[model samples]
Each structure stands twice: as C-alpha cells, then as structure tokens.
Target chain A: MSQAPSDIDDLIDLMARLPGLGPRSARRAVLRLIQKRGKLMQPLAQAMQGVADTARECLQCGNIGSDDLCKICASEKRANGEICVVEDVADLWAMERAGVFGGRYHVLGGTLSALDAIGPEDLRIPALVRRVTEEGINEVILALNATVDGQTTAHYIADELAERCAVTSLAQGVPIGGELDYLDDGTITAALKARKGF
Target chain B: MSQAPSDIDDLIDLMARLPGLGPRSARRAVLRLIQKRGKLMQPLAQAMQGVADTARECLQCGNIGSDDLCKICASEKRANGEICVVEDVADLWAMERAGVFGGRYHVLGGTLSALDAIGPEDLRIPALVRRVTEEGINEVILALNATVDGQTTAHYIADELAERCAVTSLAQGVPIGGELDYLDDGTITAALKARKGF
Candidate 1:
C-alpha cells in the first residue's frame, strides 16, 4: 500500500504525459537512465538541463530556440518575400530539411477545430496576417495538413490574405490525415515543388 | 547553397543520433518543436530541461532516477532476496507492468558483444555479482532478450552464480529474437510464471 517516493512517482507521472509513452514506459525509461548514468543517463540529463536553462520560444516565428528570435526568423537571407505557413513547427522543419524552401516560415501552432473549440484567433492566424503585411511577403504558402481542421484553417488564412498576397499550398502528395511529422523529406520537397494555387 | 545555422544543424545532428530517428525524422521533429513553441514545443523543451536537471542514474541498479539510488533500489520492500536481471530498462518495465515479479531488478545495461567490443565489464555483470553476494540474494532471474548475445550473457551469468544461488530465466513465451518491450503485459507475465531453471 505504500507509494513510490514522491520524486520517482512525479517522474513517472510526467513521463506518462508524453506522447506514445505510458506510465509503464516512463518507469522503464527512468530505470534505464539510472542504470546507464555514466554513459547515457547522465549525458541525457545534462542535455536536458542545458536546454531547460536556455531554451525559449523564438519571439518572431514561435520556433523553440535558445534565443529570443529563432534561427530562421533572424536570418536576413531567409526574408525572400516568401513565407511558408505551416500548421505546426514540424511542418516548417520538414520544409527546411527539404532544403529547397528559400524563405522563412509562420508556425500556426494548430489548426482550426470545432470539436476542440479551436478558432483562427486561437492559432497564430492573426500573427500570420500581421507578418504578411509587415514583412512585405509576396507569397504565403499554406502547408497545413489535409485534415478537416487543417483545411479549414488553411482556407481561413487564404481568405484573409487573398486580397493582399499570392496564396498556394503544398501539392497533393501528403496522404489524407497524415501528419507532417510522418512524411519523408523527399515527399515534402516534391509536394512543396508542385504547389498549386489554393 | 548556404547551410542551416550551426546551432540548428547541431541540434539536428544530435537528434539524428536518437534510436529509430534518422536525420530526416530529427529535422522534422525539430521543426515541429519550432512551430508549436507555445503549446507542444515549449512544453517539450521545458520537460526536457527539467529531466536534464533532475534525472540521474541509480548508483546501485543503473536505473534512471531523480537521485543517486532509484526508487526500486531505495525501497526496503523491494529487497526480497530476489533480483530480476534485464538487458534494458524497457524489459525491466515490462516486468513491472506485468505486476508478476515482487522482487527488485538489476539492469545489465546491455549484453556482451564481441562485434561491438562489449564485455562483461562493459555491462553490470560485476555489479550484479557483487549484489548477489553482498545483498544475500537467494534467486537471480535472467529476463534478458532472446537475441544470441542476450542468451550468451545469460549463460555467462548463470555459470558465474551456479553455486551461489537459484538461477532462472524467462520461459519460451518470448518469441525468438523478441524484445521484451514489444511484448504485452499478459505475455510477459505468462512468461515469468512459466520460467524454469537456467
């Protein structure tokens, strides 16, 4: 009936909250870290600590970075009058990995959702709008997901920006309901290359 | 022709090194973090930082813990004169989730591997032997993987402890070349229940 120590229990609880990891997996992960303290666990812990101390949200692009502005937003060369608008940072990273999108990005954080009560305002839609006007962007690429919410958000953004800038989307290579995280770099690049008007 | 900034590249390089994550996946994951900085990415970064600061290896059993000794190793109730040995923490967690074993665990870190230049010393074999004699252990259960190296390591441990204590192994329910992490709780429990002399 006695409970595990508070710290261990806390760790397990927190780990359980991570995606694809349950309480059991968390326990195992914790145990493994303890066992390989010198080689794996300690280094992992140190990395976590360093990141914790320095990691922050990039003020301009919402990317997780160690500085106020993310590497992408701070780069002058990336300000090529084109902005890749994505539903999530993962999508933006996917574009970057393709190494073809010679522009910056706008991370919307999430898609519009009626079920989740998410709306355009709930996402960074307003910020995205502001960026298009302030940054003198000519093209705003909609790289949102193909999900209902994703499309809804994309349509909303496109509608809001229709009068101001050229709007396009990644080609139909991403499978329906597929997350950007699941796509290969090649597929993302191909999709981006074949983008069509929204 | 320009490369990604050094810090971003460094992050990608480190992420690519994670198991099951290649350069592509790492880049995608990092990008995801950037986009969802406020919700998913920022929280993840904070969680990683917290774990980094607090996570440490259990000196006694090689489990990850917030302190020097892991929760299992520190608990007096877990000291039941029986130590279940596993190749990885994932396996140890599988056993715990099965809720079959009442004893504590000894994480071997990994199995002996001539190809990887790994040896008994590289694993926790020496610590395990020390635990057997020092802790007055009665039984040592080998719950390693079904790989050749896992079986070889089990045999080595059995030979070392033949005269000292009861040595047993997980039963045949574990599929050939199966990893304990992939096994369901029921199967693991069944395997544990049907365990026989090594």
Candidate 2:
C-alpha cells in the first residue's frame, strides 16, 4: 500500500478514538475533511482548538463549561432549591435539552460499579454532598439510568443525604409515544406498577 | 435548554457535517473530547491543523498529499506502463490497501453524473488523457465503482482513450468469500457471464 501522509493518518487514528466512530468511518471522515479543507476542515480545527483552550469542568457541579462554574450552577433562576443528580455530562446535557428541569445539576461523572471497582469516592459524590449544604439545596433528585449500577449509585446517594434533604427519583413508566407491545418486559412491568389515572 | 458554550456548539456542528456522524454522535464525540482535552482532543486538533495547513491535491493524480506530486506519482518503480483509474481517492486507497496493483493511479475525484451535473471536465479526465502519452502508458485500467455513474464514467474514459492505448476494466463477479444467495441479481449475472476455469 502507498504511504498515506503521516499527518492524515494521525488525524484518522485520533478520530477513530471518538465514541461512535471506528477505523472505516474515521477514514471516510478524514477524506471528507481533506476534500473540504478550506470550508469545513479549517473551521473544525479552529473550533476544536478554541474549545480545548477554554473548556473546563465546573468545580461545583462537575459540568463542562468555559468557567469554573457551569452556566446552570451560576444561574440563580435554575437554583430552585433542587439538585438533579446524573451519571455524566452527556446525561446532564440530555436533561437540559428536555427543558423540563428548572433546578441545578450534580454530574456524578459515572455511576458506582462494583464489577469495575468504582465507588462513590471515585466519582464527584463528595463534591455533591458539599454542594447540597453550600447551595442550600432542598431536594436531591436522582435522574440516573435504569441500570444496576445506576440504581446502586442512586441508593447510595439517597442514604448519604437521607437526613440532609428530600430524596426522590424519576418516575419509571412507558416513554411518550412508545408502544406497549414493543416495550421491554422490565419497562412494561414498571409501567404497570407505576400506573396512574388517565 | 441551557446554552452550550458557543464554541462547543460550533465544534458539534462541524463534526455533524462529517459523512457518518449525526447530531447525537457529534454531541457524544464532543463530550468525549472535552473530557480528554489534554490527551486526545488536543492532539486531534493539532493534527487537523497540520493537515489543513499542508494537505494539497496531487497535481498529476488528483490524490491527496502534502506536496505537488503524491508519493505514488513521484516513485520511479511504480511507473510500470500501467495506470489504474478510480472514481475517487478513497477508492484509490482501497486498491492500495489490497496491495494487488503495482502501477500508478489517476483519481477522477468523482464519477460522471448527469443528475448532479458532474461532467468529465469537472473531474480529472482531461489530465488523465494528457498523462497517457506524456508518461508513455501502455494500458488504462478502469477500477471505477459498480454504480451506474461509475460504469458510465468508465465507458466515457475508455472511448476517450480508445485509440490512444488499450483500455480495460476490473472484472465484475462475486466478491471473495461472498455467498451466492446473498449476491444481487446484477452481480450474479455478471459472475456467471465471467465464469473462469477453477
């Protein structure tokens, strides 16, 4: 095979490391980047550089932002005496996109996992505990995933803040516009158990 | 939704422009980059910048490189009286990966497509014809794709260089390790017509 220029190959390797991309997709992306170097590639590089230089983890909420405090944590309007706990920044972003949550957030970075040897100390649990009191938080809402580790982490956090604040979790039920026939057995059971008046 | 830092949004928009990536995947990719800013994101940004500053299309073959002539075009050993014609640089790279061809290449950049109004002049067809006599080529091999536009471009090129030299095309048949049942009808017909002695 002819030698692909080293820089181009390096870019492809780095791109392949991204979450949803593999070697084949990385190659395709690189080819497109090269073709549109002037319009897209250059702008993408500049954007990446700008983000790299400015992006930082929020000290209070563990959210990603340019400043020490994420915009949500800095906003007085969002601090409605509630703090929503999530697994990662991605989940935090998902909640923000829903536009339903008016409270501040505490990103755990990851859920507690015994199999992976991850514990509360390994995450931002200590910071979250401090934030509850420092920010005068009234309720701690666990918006964790419906996974074993996510539940374990939520239970642990609930116990930690049992006396300090009101602890709650998101209601488990059928998603909006979802079909019962296509739903998983676990989800169907949850939906049945959590059934309410129509 | 809380405002994602504008730079972060910009990066995500650029990543979504890549061939295989969508908005969700781009968000995930950007999140990963933010988390690993020092390790992966910085290097990727630098690599992209490097390529953006240096990468240019090879004047002769229309292949991507950092110099005027691509390595394949500059190499004396590859000037073996044969030129493989491919529809794009990605296809040229695929052929190189197989390591079966031992000659130079002519990248058309794209196939002739009437619907897209992509004509031979829009690609490197004129340059390819010019190379035929200028470089003392013996045969022009068409390795264009199996698409309608690909075949149409191949026929057009063959006719253009018909009297100048021998024009051949890649043999169409079942792919290696491919199952007959899974093969398309066109491929099955082509394979039967081009059946060889085992």
- Best-performing candidate as measured by DockQ: 2
Scanning candidate 1 chain B in windows of ten residues, the lowest lDDT window is B1-10
Estimate candidate 1's alpha-carbon lDDT, on a 0 to 1 scale.
0.74
**Each model's DockQ score:** 0.16, 0.73
Looking at model 1, give its docking quality level: incorrect
Estimated TM-score for each candidate: 0.63, 0.97
User: Model 2, B1-198: lDDT tens per residue?
Assistant: 225777798889899999899999999999999999999999999999999999999999988999999999999999999999998888998999899899999999888989999988998899999999999999999999989889999999999999999999999999999999999999999999999999
Query: Which of the numbered candidates is closest to the native, going by highest TM-score?
Result: 2
What DockQ results for candidate 1? 0.16
lDDT of each: 0.74, 0.92
What tens-digit string does per-residue lDDT give for candidate 1 at A73-166?
A: 8889999999988876566666777788999888788888889899888888888889899999999999888777887888888899999999
